[model samples]
Target: MRVEDAPEAWEVVSSTERFKGRVFDVVTDGVRMPGDEVADRDYVRHVGAVAVVALDADDRVLMIRQYRHPVRRLLWELPAGLRDVEGEPLAETAARELAEEAGHRAATWHTLVDLLTSPGMTDERIRVFLARDLTPIPEEENGFVPRHEEIGMPVEWVPLPDAVEHALMGMIHNAPAVAGILAAYAASVEGFTGLRPADAPEA
Candidate 1:
């Protein structure tokens, strides 16, 4: 299942963590490359994450507006979360994030897209799921209090086509959100018969 364009081009000789953070770690790797070349590559090692492109029966996409301090902008994005829970399945991560962030659950789920957030900078992979047939869960029933950045986040339901237009028009800058909306729109154009299983292996 190797991608023809992504051949293994380097062999790692050693790896050392330069800095460890709550979310990710910076690592320096000594590698041997073709033509007897050796080099040190510094990059981020991430725990990965999942996002949900949740659509209701009316075909509106659920989105959240949250301020990203690093980027210094408020972004409208699909519900997403880090894969911090060890041994959690990817689909389960998506479902949990949907509930925790958007307070919704879906009866139908399918894998929409998998993305390597930044190939040269981080080994962070994200799985985006198409979630349909949604039911909202009240905060009293979920018993999960939104904190930190999640506090006071604004949630909205935008028409899917409008979302797709926003994503394509650069209004949605978050990588997973843009990709998820475009993927969902493309799937809809195909009558949604081409979506992969929720647990499909990453390509």
Candidate 2:
């Protein structure tokens, strides 16, 4: 629970409006040292979020291509969202986001793991989930079908082989999405990794 000898060495600095009018705050804290000494430290205080790494019956990973305004780049990542309300449980957020963002429901859903997106100064954690037996129920106000170039958020079925390949090749390069993929792979060893395009024994 503690970090660098100071488990609770953080406090919210200033709350501000996040994207879509969401509110977030910056946290300032200190690192507790030996003999209970404290040194100043600060981080981006975030409520954290949940991300789902879903797989269809065909063993394909569901992904979304998003054009991040901040980074000014298009990224392929697992469906993810911020924790909306105070009493909102992570699973609830995950399920809701999976539908709203990815437009799908999982017949089988399980929490794979939790990842600290940035442990240096921020407590930004993202819960990684493994979702299976998915059914598409597209959400309104999502995808390129809605606003096209204005919002480059679209879902695509990315095969596992290409997923890893592109990742290794620096194609699908989003931190949370990459973490979700690795976590999913660690959870289901019997499920992914083994065959490659070059290993097909010639077409």
Candidate 3:
């Protein structure tokens, strides 16, 4: 048998929106189980997100430190953003985030990995892209103004090997960043021959 993740939908007897927030919504669903028992499952409804592992020609990955309030700590994370725009391509979202947050754009892009991001608790999904051929965006041409935790965020270029080590050492706590860094490292071992196109279909 092939090893794969197959999709199946249990019958949802009823669903109710429990709360609506700026970034995501909480919902409760009454689902019918295999034994005919109905149970209420609470999960977050998310709009999804995209992240970029921007690798420069020197093999350094673009990184930024931002204060994540919920965790009450500053975290090193990849350039990322919510999928808030309607009908925008995922690659475009990734590019926009990279330029706005990291002040760079990529000439080459590939799908490095797809993540569920705590599927048991939230329906949040993220696409991590491997971006290369980076060119810094001139300050005058970039108009994005950082606010809140993003304000005064420090951007750094860390060697890919160092990044992988940091993640393994529990220094990089951001989920997508850890996954992307590891995935990028694995792909690079094969000269990135098996990476999917930037516009690959979402899992």
lDDT winner = 3
Say which candidate scores most in TM-score. 3
Ranking of models by TM-score: 3, 1, 2
Task: Tell me the alpha-carbon RMSD of every candidate.
Answer: 1.9, 9.3, 0.7
Range of the 10 consecutive residues with the lowest summed lDDT in candidate 1: 2-11
lDDT values, one for every candidate:
0.92, 0.70, 0.96
In the range 38-156, model 2's lDDT, one tens digit per residue, is 66655676778888889888778999888887789988888888887688777777877788777788877777666777788676777777788898885554442435432547779
Tens digit per residue, CA lDDT, model 1, 1-203: 96554636578989999999989999999899778688899999999999999999888999999999999999999999999999888999999999989999999999999899998989999999999999999778787688999999899999999998998788999999999998999999887899999999875
Give model 2's TM-score versus the native structure. Answer: 0.74
Give the TM-score of each candidate.
0.94, 0.74, 0.98
After superposition of all CA atoms, the RMSD between model 1 and the true structure is 1.9
Candidate 2 local accuracy as lDDT? 0.70
- Write the residue-wise lDDT of candidate 3 on 99-125 in tens digits: 999999999999999999998989999
Off by over 4 Å in 1: 1-9
